[model samples]
Every structure is written in structure tokens, then in C-alpha cells.
Target: MDLAIETNNLKKYFGDIHAVDGIDLQIPRGSLFGVLGPHGAGKTTTLRMLSTILHPTSGEAAVLGFDIKKDAREIKKRIGVCPQELVLYPRLSARENIHLIAQMHGMAKKDYKERTDELLGKMNLLDRASSLVKGYSGGMKRRINVLMAVIHEPELLFFDEPTAGLDPQSRRVVWDFIRDFQEKESTIILTTHSMEEADDLSDELIIIDHGKIISQGTPDELKGKLGEGDILEFKIKEMEQRDEIIELAKTLDFVRWGKPVGKHRIVLNALDGLRRVSEIMDVVKVKMEDISVRKNTLEDVFIDLTGRRLRD
Candidate 1:
């Protein structure tokens, strides 16, 4: 199999801080890959090194077969990056921003015009192409930021929190765009905090924490690591009852394990959760509310592996 990106013990440091420490990855060509972690987890720093924007303190990586250190320029030409923060000229119209990026990439005027128009149409922003970015909503700016990255039609794309703050509708639009791009056989590296988004878009994913890879697999494969069980979650009337609920849940025969999510919530792993719900309720019905049962999910896997919520 052809690999689009490869890293060997990739490390980056700022003084004594190991921002990205000993991460090894092999991303296949034309695959949609996800990197998931919380704030300060080095997701962005790792991407920066892979994208040739930062030099690694130690270790090596190649993007699209070009060495990240030795062939940084070549790698830059074949890759596009959409950073977590908006990077657009507020005074420029959406069309102009995309046009400028295309020009910088050395695209022919005719080709860029067509490409810009096509992207705007797909993003549903063609009608507002002439509007200055300053007048656009946050979602609109995000859409334009994405368009700017792909204007060069790069072979490898890196998106850091592509839909971080968009409304649901706008976020879906971006998701659709990503799907369409993948159909074109472009390799994409995505970093996000949204477990649902990662579950939906990634062909494979890795969970990173404290600058190291904790887990890596397909979504189903990762969830499978958690074993076969349904998830049971409930909220208590008082924060003080959380520990009591967890203890009660653990005592139940059906509960495999139980933990307190926050001061007022408890989550449990159980088989046949629906059938066991009545039994679970019997123990904490007086203190619990908003009880729910569902199948194991990526979020569950994340929490179980990290012992903390994804957003933490």
C-alpha cells in the first residue's frame, strides 16, 4: 500500500516542553485520517511540523513522499492547510481571497477563476462571493477559510478543527465538502475535538494526549477495544449523590464498571443495558434523573482510554 504520510518518533519541543513527543504514524494514501485530543495536546503542533511550517526538535516525517525537513517547499506545494484560527483578510471579498491564494500558488487566471467559482458554488457562498469577509458571519468566514486552503487543489490536506465553531447546518456543509474532496482521492489529515465528526469522517483515527499517541485504529476497531457493552448514563438530583450512584451501579450484577462523569452525573458499562435499566433505576431512582442507555461510541472509547472526557 502507498503511504501518503509517514513519521518516525516525531518530536517537537519548546525549551523544555515536549509539544509533540515520539509520535509515530503511517497514514495511507487517499485516506481520511483523524487526530483527536483536547486543548494543549499538541495536535496543532504535530500538524505544523508535518505541513512544513515548523521544524521538529527531533525525529523525521515525510508528506506525500517529500521529506518534511529536506523537501519542505515541495511538500508545501502539494499540501493545503486550514488552521484552527481564521486566516483571511477581513477587507477582501470571498472571491478575492480565494483568487489571491490561487495566484500565489501560480494557478493560471482561467483555471483559478473556474476553481474559485466551483468551490464557492459547492460551499453555497457563490451568491455572496462579492461580500467582504468583515461583513460575513463566523460560519461564512470559516467556509471561506476552507475554500482558500483547497484553491490550489492540493494532494494532501490538513484541517485543524475545520468545524470548531460553525452552526450545525454550516458544519454539515463542510462535512459534505470534505466527503466530496475525499471522493477525488485526496489524502486528508484532520484534527478535531468532535468525536461524532471524527466517527463520521475518518477512515482511521488516533487519540493523542500529553504529546503521545494513546490509541490508533478505525472507529469500530477502537470502540471494540472497550469490549461489548452498552453505555448507561444518568444525572443525579444533587452533586453529593454522584459517588453514591456510582457505588450503587457498581454493586449491580449487570454493571461491568461505573464512574462519575462530573459532580452530578454517573456513567456505567453494562450488557443488555435496556433490560438492566429497571434494575439500575431501582438502586438510584430516588437520586437519579435524565437516565439514558445507548450503544458504545467513540466518545465512550475516548473517555475510557483517557479517563477524561474528550473536551477536557
Candidate 2:
């Protein structure tokens, strides 16, 4: 396979902190690859190194076949980076912001004009394109930020939490844009804390924690690693009873594992889940407010591997 991005023991450090510790990756061309982790798991640092915004302390990587360290400028030219924090000119109008980015990328005026108009229309911001970015809603700014990144139509794109604060409708629009890009054979690397977004958008994903990869595979493959089972979630009427229900679940032979989630929920991994539901429910029947059973998900895989939830 033709790899769009590859890294070999990539490491970055800040004093004693190993922000990105020895990550090796092989992302194929045209794949919507996902990097998932919690707040301090080095997802942003890793992306910064890949996009040539930060030089790694050690190790190496290539983006679109150009060395990130030695050919940083060349790599920058072929890649678009939508950072976790918005990087827009608040004083500029939305169209002006995109136009400025296109100019910086050395795009011809005619090309950029057409590209900008098309993107604004697609994002449903054509009517507001003349408005200053400082006055735009958070979601509108995010949408413009994304457009600015791709104004030059780069071959490889890096989106760091692209839909972080978008409403459902706006988020779906971003998702659709990503899907359309993938269909056109552009390699996209995305980092997100949202498991649902990762599951829905990623062709393959890696879950990172403490600057190291704990799990990596297709969504279904990662879930399969949890073994054959259904995930049983119970919402208790009283939050104080969570631990007791989890302890009771642990005592069941059919249950592989159980843990308290949030304040009122207890999640369990069980075999023959349908057949065992009644037996499982009987234990928590008195305290249970609601219950659900489903196949394992990426979130469950994260909890199982890291011993904590994704947001933690």
C-alpha cells in the first residue's frame, strides 16, 4: 500500500514529560485515520510534529513521502492543518479569511475566488461570508477555520478536534465534508475525544493514553479484543448504590468485568448476555432505574484498556 504518512518511534518531550512517546504509525493513502485519546494524551503534540509545526525531540516521520524534519516546508505545502484552537483573523470577513489563506498558499486569485465561494456555499455560510469573523458564532467560526485549511486543496489533511464544539447539525456537515474528501482520495488524519465521531468516521483508529498506544485497529476489531460479550449498562435510581451494583455484578460468573460509570450507571461485560439478562437484572432490580444491553463499542474498549473513561 502507498502510505500517506509514516512515523518511526516518534518522540517529543518537554523537560521530563514524554508528550509523544515512541509512536509508530503507517497510515495508508486515502484513509480516514483516527487518533483517539483524553485531554492530556499527547494527541495534539503528535499532530503538531506530523504537520511540521513542532520538531520532534527524536525519531522520524514522513508526510506525503517528504521527511517532516528535513523537508518541513515541502510537507507543509502538501498538507492542511486545522488546529485544535481556531487560527482565524477575527478582523477579516469569512471570505477574506479564506482568501488570505489561499494567497499565503500562493493560489491564483481566480482559483481561490471560485474555491472560496464553493466552500462557503457548502458550509451554508454564503449569506454571512461578508460578515467579520469576530461576530460569528462559535460553530460558524469553526466552519470557516476548516475552509481556510483546505482552501489550497492539499493532498493530506490533519484535523485536530475539528468538530469539538459544533452543534449536531454543524457537526454532521463537517462529517459530510470529511467523507467527501475521503471519497476524493485525500488522506485525512483526525484526532478526537468523541468515540461516536471516531466510530462513525474512521476507517481505522488508534486509542492513545499516557502518550502511548493502548489499542489500534478497525472499530469492530478493537471491540472484538474485549472478547465475545454484550455490554450491559444499568442506571441506578440512587447514585450512592453504584459501587454496590458493580460489586454484585463482579460476583456473577457470566460477567467478565464491571465498573461504575458516571454517578448513576454501572457497566458490565457479559457472555450470553440475552440469556443472562434476567439473572443480571435480578441483582440490581431494586436499585435499577433503567438498563440496556448492546455489543461492545469503542468507548467500552477504551474503558477496558485504560481502566478509565475517554473523558478522564
Candidate 3:
């Protein structure tokens, strides 16, 4: 199978801080691959190295078969990167900004004009295409940023939080746009804070923490790693009582595992969790703010592996 990206012991460091420490990856062609990590987990740093914006401290990597070090200019020509921070001209109209990227790629005027209108329509920004981007809302600008990245029609794309500020309706539009883009057999490397986005779009995903990959699999496979069970979430009124409840939860044989999530919520994985809710509640003996039981999700597997929620 042709590979879109390949890496071996990739590393990046800043003084004593090893930002991306010795990692390997293999992403197949045309896959929507996800890179998930909490803040400072080296997701962006790794992307930079792979995109040729940052030189790696060590290791070898290839993007679209071009050596990241030797063929950086060639790699840059074939890839589009939408960074976490918006990169756009405040004075440029949305159409002009996208056209500029197309121009950089040496696209014909007619080709860029037609593609610009099509992309703008898909992002729900065609009506605003003539307007200066500075006047646009955060979400609208975000959508434009995405458009600029893809205007060149690169074979490989890297999106670092493409829908950070979008509303539900607008977010769905971007999701649909990405889905449509992937259908063209383009490879996308995405890093997102939204688990729903990752679960919905990623063909495979890796969860990174402290510059190391802790877990990787399909979203369902990662969730399945937590075993068969339901999740019982108990919201405690008093944050100080979490430890006591965790200890109490350990005594219950029905509970497969238990951990605290967020500020005052304790989550437990248990077999037949719905039926054991009352018994589990009886054992807690705490001031309960609320409680609910639901099936395991990718976030649950993330929490179980990293020992904290994605935001934390």
C-alpha cells in the first residue's frame, strides 16, 4: 500500500524539554488520520516538523514520499497546513485570500476563480466572499482559513483545529466539506480538541500525552479497550469528597474501574451498570449533585488511558 506519511523515532526538543520524543507513525494514503493530545503534548510541534516549518532534532520522516529534511521544499509544495492560530490578511477579501494561495501554487486565474466560488459556497461563506475578512466573525474567518489551506488542492493536508470557533450548524458544514475533500482520495492529518470531530472523521487516531503516544486505534477499538460496560457518572456537590467516593467505589466488586473526571464528577466502568446504579449510589454515601449512566465513549477511553480529561 502507498503511504502518505511515515516516520521513525522522530524527536524535537527545546533545551531540556523534549517536545516530541522518539515516535514512529505510518499513515496510509487517503486516510483521515487524527492526532489527539492535551495542551503541550507535542501535537503541533510534530505537525510543524512534518510540514517542514521546524527542523527536527533527530529522526527521519517522509511526507508524501518526500524526505522531510532533504525534500522540505518539495513537501511544502504538495501539502497545505491550517495552523491552530489563524493566518490571514485582515484587509483581504475572503475570495482574495483564497485566491492568493491558489496564486502561490501557480494555478490559472480561471481555475482559482471557479474553485474559490465552489469552496466559498461549500463553507456557507459565498454571500460573504466579497467582504473583507477582518469584518467576519471568528467562525467565518476560521472557515476561510480552512479554504485558504485547500485552495491549492494539495495532496496532503494538515488541519490543526479547523473548527475551533464554529457553531453547530457551521461546524457540520466544515465536517461535510472535509468528508467531501477526503472522498477525492486526499490524505488529511487532523489535530482537534473535539472528540466528536475525531470520532466522526478519523479513520484511525492516536492519543498523545507528555510527548508520547499512549493509545492508538480506531475510535471504536480504543473505546473497546476499556472492555464491555456502561459508564456511571456521579456528580458530587462537594469536590473534597471525591477521594472518599473513589475509595468506596473500589470496594464494589461490580465496578470494573473508577476514576474522577472534571472538577467534581467521578466516573465508574461497570458490568450491568444500569442495574447496579442504586447499589453504587447506596455505597457512595455522599452529597450527590446528579448521576447518569451511559455507554462508553472515546473520551472515556482517553480518560482511562491518560488519567485525565482531554482539556485537563
Candidate 4:
């Protein structure tokens, strides 16, 4: 298989802190790979090293078949990065900002001009293309940030929290843009705290925490790791009764495991959840505002592995 990225026990340290520790990865060309974790999980550091912006303390990596250490310049030429923090000139118009990046990449004027207009249209910013970035809303700036990174049409793209502050409509637009880009066989490495986004976009993903990959797999495969079971979630009418309901649920023979999901809610892993709803309700003995039965989700898999939500 042709690999776009290959890392062997990659490590990076900042004095006393080990930001990235011995992470091994093999990402194939034309694949959409996701890196997920909570804050301080080293996702950004790994991307920086692979992008040739930072040197690794130890181990080796190859980006687009070029050695990251010795061929840093070659790697940069083929990759685009949309960093976690927005990078846009507030005083520049959206068109100017994107055009400037394309020019720096040495693209032909005709090609970049056409590409810039197309990107602006795709991001729903063509109407505001001439407006200075300082007057744009947060979501608009984020869309422009993404547009600038992709204007050069690099073979590999790194998106760190690309939709961090986007509204639902804007997020959908960006998601469609990324999908269209990948349809052209571009390799994309994405790092995000949004479980739904990762589950939807990734062909395969790695969950990193404490500077190490804790789990890696397709969304379905990771959820399958929890084994066969339906999830029963009950929204309690009274917040004070949640704990008591959970304790009662644990004692039920039909329930495999029971735990609190969020405030006023308790979830149970059990077989035949739909048929056993009455039994579960009888056990909990609490007034529930709502009850839902569903299959395993990526968020569930993450919580199972990390003992916390992705945001935590």
C-alpha cells in the first residue's frame, strides 16, 4: 500500500513535559484519518512535527514518502495546515488573504484567481469576499482560514478543530467542502474534539491521551469493541433522584452496566432494551421525563476507553 504518512515511535519533548511520546502511525494516501483526544493530548504537536514546523525529539516519520527530518522542505511543499488557532489578517479582505497564500505557494495567477473565487463560493463567502476580515463574524473567519489552507490544493491537508466555532449551517458547508476535496484523492489528517464530526468524516481514527494512542479503529469497529448490547438512556424528571436510579439500575439482573451520562440522565447497557423497558423503569422507580433506546455510538466508545467525554 502507498502510505502518505508513516511514523515509528515518534517522540517530542518540551523540557520536563513529554508532549508526544512514541506514537506509531501508518496513514494511507487518499484516506481521511482522524486524531481525537482531550486537551493536551499532543495531536497538534504531532501535526506540527509532521508538517516540518517542529523537530521531533526522537523517532522517525515520513510525510508523502519524504523523510520529515531530512526532507522537511519537500514535505512542506505538498501539505496544507489549518491550525487549531485561526490565522488570518484582520485588516485584509477575504479575497486578499486567500490570494496571498496562493501567491506565496507560487501558483499561476489565472489558476489561483479562479480557485480563490471557487473556494469563496463554496464557503458561502463570495458575497463578502471583498469585506475586511475584521468585520467578519467568528464563523466567517474560520471558513476563510480553511479556504486559505486549501487554495494551493496541496496533496495532504491537516485540519485541527476546523469547525471549532462554526454554527450548524456553516459547519455543514465546511464538511461538504472537505468531502469534495477528498473525493479527488487528497489525503486529509484531521484532529478534533467533536465526536460526531470524527465519526462522520474518518475512514479510520486514533484516540490519543497522555501523549500515547489509546485506541485506533473505524467508528463501527471501535463501537463494536463494547460488544453486542443496546443502550438505554433515561432522562430523570428530578435531578436528585439520578444517583438513586443509577444504584437501583445496577442491581437489575438484565442490566450489564449502568452509569450516569450527564446531569439528570443514566444509561444502561443491556440486551433487549426495548422489550425490557418496563423492567428497567420498575427498577429505577423514578419519574423519567424521557427514555431512549439506541445502539453504541463513537462517544460511548471514547468514554469507555478514556473514562471521560472528548471535551474533557
Q: What is the TM-score of each candidate against the true structure?
A: 0.93, 0.91, 0.94, 0.89
Residue 182 displacement in candidate 2 (angstroms) = 1.3
What does candidate 1's lDDT look like per residue over 1-312, in tens digits?
799999999999999898999999999999999998888889999999999999999998989999998999898888999999999999999999999989988999999999999999999999999989999999999999999989999999999999989999999999999989989999999999898899999999999988999999999999888678899887777667667777877788778877777556777899898787888878865556798989988888877876677876
Q: Write the per-residue lDDT of candidate 2 for residues 180-221, one digit (tens) a residue.
A: 877978999999999989999999999999888888999888
Backbone clash total, candidate 4? 0
Pairs that collide, model 4: none
Report every candidate's CA lDDT: 0.90, 0.90, 0.89, 0.88
Give the alpha carbon lDDT tens digit for every residue of 1-312 in model 4. Answer: 999999999999999899999999999999999998888899999999999999999999999999998998888889999988889999999999999999988999999999999999988899999999999999999999999889999999999999998899989988998999999899999998788888889999998987899999998888888767888877877777776777788787767777676566667787788899898778777776688899887777776775566675
- Which residue pairs does candidate 3 place in steric collision? none
Candidates, ranked, TM-score: 3, 1, 2, 4
State model 2's lDDT. 0.90
Candidate 1 residue 223 C-alpha distance from true site, Å: 1.4
lDDT at 264, model 3: 79
State model 4's lDDT. 0.88
- The worst-scoring run of ten residues by lDDT in candidate 3 lies at 281-290
